[model samples]
Target: MTADRDTLPLPPLAPDMQAVMDRLMAEDGVQPDPTLLPPAEGRAKAEAANRRWNGPAPAMARELIVETPGGRRAFVFIPPSDTGREAILYIHGGGWAFCSAATHEGAARRLALATGAPVITFDYRLAPEHPYPAGLDDCLSLWAEREHILSGRRWSVSGDSAGANLALALMIRLKNRDLPHCGLLFYGVFDADFESPSYRQVADGPGLTRGKMQRYWDFYAPEERRSSDPCLTPARASDEVLAALPPLYLNAAEVDPLRSDSEALAARLHALGRKDPFDTVPGVVHGFMQMSIWLPQAEAAFDRAGEAFRTMT
Candidate 1:
């Protein structure tokens, strides 16, 4: 089935961004389907696409394997002017089923350069093959073994899309574990609700849509489990739990189906008398952070993320 492109409520993409969206549309990206193509193939395709959009890789980044309990691969980016005090553990977004650490290494490298700190991105397990607690558990294992990754260093967790979801959930999971983590969430999927205002307004997207996200949720945690698990649905968190979270820096795409996810998170935090800063990158959709090579707004968003890392840590 093809969408009526003429009438879709598409985001007002920037001049440069129009090209990227055009490519997706040409490739029939209306709905996401990582299941049809194996994850390795999907990741290779994404890495190729990202390389074209990402222009050049940051000079000081390398890929390494981390033997978490789950045994995932990771990309580590080092800044030219690095201090050993702070680091970022970035997770890439692919609806929790696609993309990889290599696919998002460009953005991570930009962040490392901007923050003057090392940024480590993990290739965590995905869903429908590994499923819900699997991906989250892989992240948690890394946190449990953070001493091996970086001992005595202040590190913050950050991710885009589903990666952001993991970052937020890990903050909650490790809240009482005496870990030093502040969260940098970029257009996260914080709730199971599919009827939020942004979901309605930007539902049938030029990028992400209501139906596509539902598919992702179904793959991550079947409907029966999503509602009852606050880890999967962060918005369902109680005021006390929300209050206990580390200082968070929430960034959202102004014209994104998941925009309200960030708003929902902001509201929950405010209800607990916490004042976390939320910034919406204008004229872009979800996944803008990875398009920094061509999109100025993406670069600007990374600048904000770097500043957030500096402020939070």
Candidate 2:
């Protein structure tokens, strides 16, 4: 009973966003060339999703090759205005399986302009193919090579969706290495259990859906080691480890299932006096930033997030 890829249903989506989703589904990418990684294909789809995005004139943002002792990884560099050169290591979100430096070009360019920080956005390895630790390694290597940027400096870290998850994983990794952190998240996933209150309350709402999330994890989480690693799912990590993370600016869309992941984690951090900044954007849905015109509330949310990222660092 094998199913044809072309016939697969598009995931349940937000009504406000249905037209865009329909258009995206219509121009479906040919199955990727074998030379391309699965993550690369996912990124292509995201770029196609916003084919009309002619974002701000970036000061300067371009693809870069970062060669580290660990390995060669790709990044998109958005240089800050020379007036005051701050830097942010930006991670683009997917469910740890999709999106990349290319998929998130608009957000990166706009973010650089808004925060006035040179942005280095990475294309971390995505999973079930790359699996755990591979993507994590790429993420940490980008930061380790830039310690001068992160140490007691105004260097901030930010990402949306699964990249947000990677950001937190990097914080934990940095702490373990006895390094400093400046991590922020936009509509992040902080838990793996997925049964938190927000999950139940917003599961059927616009944007992200429970069934779709399950599919995302299916593609991202390899069978052999899915539950054992905290890198893939931070909620499974102990509270002590989660508390030691750096000051964070976490946001959630009002109708996003991950909203509770943000709320619960923020509460824990607040209780422990981590005092991270967390916000719930009104009238927004999961992955709203991908279609700002379709989800106007996201622009304001992103603006507020930029402010928080500036201050948190």
Candidate 3:
């Protein structure tokens, strides 16, 4: 089925989420499908669309940028009254092609408040220009210098969608070294399998669609390397790597095509006798957490993730 928003049958979204979606749809009515646009144009449109939900960001005690390798940027969001040594490294999701630290500023601020600790986000290289190991390398560069930049704080990793994929991949890359204290993944894209149950069920979306995701994969990883590269498709990581990951807090939107990815990861962890928390938020679509300013469920999800982080730290 085509991913036509008007004709696709979708599960009901929460009232607030429905209202937010309606407003976004109206605003985007004149624009072509971003997924089909040129990378630069698509990035611009995605950034502009996210600005609405970011609404007067939650106050931050401080904000700053640190330059990483390749002259890429990393942004730090520090909440008021934060005194702990714990922090979060938040990675923004945009199918590995669109969005940036600026588009995700509000969500990072909210995360800082939710966890009562500083939150850091960065601008990784986008695909179809840099592709594959480039973005992951940028993330790794920042991680290597986290101590100097974060002032020796104990930090966990957190991300949404493709960002979550990278976060998990980072963990796999560090499986034999120092891992993050915990992980908070939201509706992450964990695997490349387009035939998964959720993929077929939500092939066309009120939000994320299977076709869009396929394009994202094509841009991010060459077909020859997709299945073999654990960093590209993290779910394919070995059982030893999976079992060695730190504590995790995962959630999936009920109507998201990526929902099953989280489910599969959680199941793998369970089989390893790990009791990590996995929440499935009903009545929402992928990237709903970006609407935390307008959706209570979004805020609540952050709160829950914060709680999970605290327990592990």
lDDT of each: 0.77, 0.66, 0.85
TM-score of each: 0.88, 0.76, 0.93
Q: Which candidate leads the pack in TM-score? A: 3
Clashing pairs in 1: none
Off by over 4 Å in 3: 1-10, 68-72
Local distance difference test, candidate 2: 0.66
RMSD of 3: 2.8
List CA RMSD, all candidates: 3.7, 6.4, 2.8
Between which residue pairs do clashes occur in model 2? none
Q: What is the model-wide C-alpha lDDT for candidate 1?
A: 0.77
lDDT of 2 by residue, 1-313 (tens): 1133224323344455566556545766333322134556655665555444535434564445555555645454555452344567888887777666777777776677666666676677777687667787888877777644333445668888888888888887776664445776888877655556666666554557665566566666654555566666665666778777777788877767787778877787777767788887665568777565445555666678778866765
Summed over model 3, clashes come to 0
> What's the residue-level lDDT of 162 in candidate 1?
92
> Using lDDT as the measure, which candidate wins?
3
Residue 38, candidate 3: C-alpha displacement in angstroms: 1.5
Candidate 3 versus the native: TM-score? 0.93
